[model samples]
Target: MSHEFTVEAGLVIFSYDGRAQFGWLDLKTGAYHAESDGRCIPDAIGAIEFHSDVTH
Candidate 1:
């Protein structure tokens, strides 16, 4: 599904209800890269760190 979107500065703004989020979209691959709050581990390094943490 495609959402209505726009580009401001360098970020792609998008939403379904007008309350939107900003991110960098790869036009060639349709990948959206956004800032993380450090809670999501999308890489091997992050997965390793999260796996090694005893407090989780």
Candidate 2:
């Protein structure tokens, strides 16, 4: 099973899989950066909630 959720922050969208895997994608440039790749997640990205039906 897999779990995922998305958060919209201004021009970018943050995507996270329930397993310490997350990244932000720039809407304009289409750039993506993962937390494990040395990219910093902004403070604006606060708590995240995974819906009960968020598994596939």
Candidate 3:
């Protein structure tokens, strides 16, 4: 998928109509609908951490 989305002043738009899928709207006057890959790790959790290739 082409995640070629761009934003002016670092702003983004996202929405969900409770239909089926979620999507991202770019600032280029275009709408990009993304699909669920349906592949997820069981028991996934969220956290606040920093990771990098060089430093943490």
Candidate 4:
């Protein structure tokens, strides 16, 4: 199964191989800011950190 979703600037995708990859998306334009390179948690964590910094 494959799926794609966005949480804030974070983009998460689950591929047919059952691997979850991470990337970034431009919030305003809703375009991809970065392509998924098989990264996972760390990329997501970075997005969360960025969001926290902006919201605080």
Task: Identify the superior model by lDDT, candidate 1 or candidate 2.
Answer: 2
Top-scoring candidate (TM-score): 1
Per-candidate TM equals 0.31, 0.26, 0.22, 0.28
Residue 36 error for model 3, in Å?
A: 3.7
Task: Write model 4 residue lDDT over 8-36, tens digit each, in one string.
Answer: 44445444455554456555844433353
State the C-alpha lDDT per candidate: 0.34, 0.43, 0.30, 0.40
Residue 45 Cα positional deviation in candidate 1, in Å, after optimal superposition: 32
Model 3, 1-56: lDDT tens digits are: 45543432221223333233333333384434342443322222221222223311
Those runs of model 1 whose alpha carbons end farther than 4 Å from true positions after fitting are: 1-8, 37-56
Order of models, best lDDT first: 2, 4, 1, 3
**Model 4, residue 55: displacement in angstroms?**
12
Worst 10-residue lDDT window for candidate 4 reads 47-56
Best by lDDT: 2
lDDT score of residue 24 within candidate 4:
60
Per-residue lDDT tens digits for candidate 1, residues 28-53, read: 95554443432221221111011111
Q: List the residue pairs that clash in candidate 2.
A: none
